[model samples]
Target: MASTVLIFSASLIALFLFSLTGVNANAGSNVFSMQSYGARGDGLHDDTKALRDAWAAACSSAKPAVLLIPKGKKYLNRHTILSGPCKSNIVLMSNLMASPKRSDWSKETIRHWILISGVTSLTITGGGTIDGNGKIWWQNSCKTNSNLPCTEAPMALTLHACKNLKVEDLKVVNSQQIQISVEDCTDVKMSPVSITAPETSPNTDDIHITRSRDVQVMDCTIKTGDDCMSIQDRTENLHVNNMVCGPRHGISIGSLGDHNSEAHVSNVTVDNGRLYGTTNGARIKTWQGGKGSAKNIVFQNMKSAVEVSDVLFKNIRGTSASEEAIMLHCSSSVPCHGITLEYVKLTVKGGSNDVRSTCQNAEWKKSGSVSPQPCSFKN
Candidate 1:
């Protein structure tokens, strides 16, 4: 598994470097500034319409386009969707903030704030901040403070049905819900990104990848209230490397096959992860009575089980917030198989060195110096 990941990482890094170089070439091409379209950049006015117009002009361009949101400006926006099957490659250098007022949102736009959909060969960079202004949303969320009705909140940024996408060198903070969502996309690469939110903030997952393929999330720093990165159903060929996750739930595989539905995910790899004081180290969670296969997953340092099989966790070293540092709760009806844990060492945070492992209805193999012991199936 290590050898395979090394090779794949090498090639994927090369490919992304090449594509990102091409994407940066647009810096010399046409520029469509948001301020030119009547935006104030004051951090108070609604800049949604101006941004929409800028996106329209950029998308319609015959040559590569650059939608520039110049530095040091904090333009406030409402639910904004930049949708396209544009004529050429598009670059969105984003530096913006979202309105904090919950009433400004409606049922139609509550799920997404800055949505970039149906665009191909898109690149988003520009070392700026995307503030979700989530103080109001967090106050209203049922998860944090009870007595409020549970309602859907907006994800700070979403990329839907996009191909050949590259998002890097950005700071995403205080998202109302999930920080960054990659859905139904292909050939996506995100690297050297920072995602942050209060540890008490509700459901602010750093990154969520679902129904996507060939996606790579590398060299990211994440501190959030939810899973640092959640890999959901129908995602394949996904790679996560050199991630720093803490003060949150660790990397998760699935809450898949929910409500007795069938789902399949395969070819996932997570490598060189550093998780500190997290609720779980490597997790794979599948609902009871759910059907589907989650297979060929190699976590060089992670867990989840939707009929999970052929999964490996290697070289994982971290401090677990709970006593059960390693937990594998596979479904009884569809037990997990071919699971392996290698060189895993996890200790409880600020407590005795008596951490434990729990394995149920799963078949596993262990190799090398595992602390708190390793799981072995009962014959």
Candidate 2:
């Protein structure tokens, strides 16, 4: 604990020193305040333009700039972008307030309400909350009502093609779909954050990472309807630790091999996870008739996909009320192979007394007290 405090203190000191330097491209930090450019922050009228202007100035600034959204303020916005290849390092500190509403977003691209992209060496730190007003979207979702046509809803926050990114101390709630998504990026870190939504809110995963590499997720609490963390195709070298998940699906890897499409996902590690009131403890699900290699995945949830392969799970302890405590529903044609388990203990919840492991064409080298055991039978 002392060492952690010292490290944090040192980081603060370094940042403070950096802030005190004169504004220059290579040496100092500048501030671009949203209020100075005319942000109402009243939560009524849209402050999109003001925030955009602040972002524009910061993006083109000659020095490292802080695009600051002050505390105790609620900024309303429509679809927004903070794209960059700025002259120097950039910091985005905002209280992401509200997302723009839409009747139907079926025709739009996956552009989030707040999209951050094309930036290198960026820091995102804030103490404010992002309210995703997902009530209407949830009511109209096709997950519970199959009669309605399936359509794509926008994410609350998205980081696209960003390298060396840091997301710290943020609260995201009630997203229409995926709360936070990172795609096509590298060297990203996220920690000490909370993401939440109602258990009945469909398709609202806490964090979804796709086609990204060298990412770290730590000390996060996620309570949502879908997977706490969903790992998709082309994602490699990922690590998640000190995670708390509840009232949702546990950490999951892929519904890969979709449409008989080939996918590659590898090198993932999930350590020290706590799951409660979830549907599945740890899961790997894939679709049939698809071809690809999904090797070297380390750990955890639910969602549909094509193929699954090579993964390791270790040191995961939790309670599961669901009958299928650990689910490894793999494809028959391309059966899951090279799975490894160690130090995983999941006890049955409630008084039912029947908690089983379900494995369909799943294989793993097992160790420790993994409930229902590994690769033994399918329920």
Candidate 3:
């Protein structure tokens, strides 16, 4: 009886230790380990096949699965997809690094490094790093040198057509282009994520949201070459709060309606954010001769005339890199109205605190210690 009790206690202790490794406790023996599938994880060997095999086993399992790419080893994967409408909920805990050699990537996959699609009720929470190893691609870009041909570079992580997804506690860095692309997804939440790249790296946006709805991004730190977060056409019900953005373009609503295409983006909110040393604090850009409407947006910092209306900017205080701290460049074809600014303050960077405002085809109201004042409504 005493020996049986000691064995039982040891089993419980082992299970408790296993739970701390980020695998689901309910997953039990359904943990598909990449190493068990023959991944060397030595940073030199290609782990793509091992990773795919692990995913396939877990994705087909009738029980809840945890695809474990365990820690303390580096894994190199080529352009890979962990695609599924799996039988049960899945968790991917990984420390995946992309192959840096241009020869390793095929032309078809030059646009994406790691693609996760069609998955539902998925959780990707590992305090692991997804390194793009992008310097080789960046060196050959047209933006690096005009003499080079403009070619497509890969986004480090692309989550497409997924619903009820949660991605948290990951560090995604050094993509050849966009770091994280959330496209055609719904009910997604990303929090406490770190996305970073060199400011001189071209088009490396931290997070790009497009055609997704009911998405929330909270407690993120983004410093990148392009927009820290760019909300594109048809994205609605997005909430971004408690974010720190810097050293590039700040949060942007659009370069929407490009090529005369119809774009519609609405019901967006950004609150409790800070922007420092950015090219634009908060901006909206829609091309001329484009058809569509961007409305019902609230930006705490700060448009386009995709018919922008019913928007509010509250508690936006920052140092502007441009002399024109507030620019409301609305489209004349469809003017913007019902804009509000409250407790706004902006001063020129590396200069006197004085700044100016510019407005065209926009009507706005201002209150509560507004500096640089509202356009055509000076105190």
lDDT of 2 by residue, 1-379 (tens): 0010010000000000112122232336788888889998787878889989998999898788888887777787766778888887888776655554564233554446778899999887765687777877787789968999887777888999999999877788888789999999999999877998998999998889999999999999998889888888989999998887776577777777778877778998877676655666556657777667777755532122234456879999777877778888776534676787777877677645477777777777776556568457322
Give all candidates' CA lDDT scores.
0.81, 0.74, 0.80
Task: Write one digit per residue (lDDT tens) for candidate 3, span 157-257.
Answer: 99999999998788888887899999999999998899888988998988999999999999998987888888899999999988877767778888877
RMSD of each: 14.3, 15.9, 18.0
Candidate 3, position 357, lDDT: 83
If scored against the real structure, what TM-score would every candidate get? 0.74, 0.71, 0.74
The 10-residue segment with the lowest total lDDT in model 1: 8-17
How many clashes (backbone N, Cα, C below 3 Å) per candidate?
Answer: 8, 15, 0
- How well does candidate 2 score on lDDT at residue 216? 97
Q: Which candidate wins on lDDT?
A: 1
**Shift of residue 230 alpha carbon in model 1, Å:** 0.7
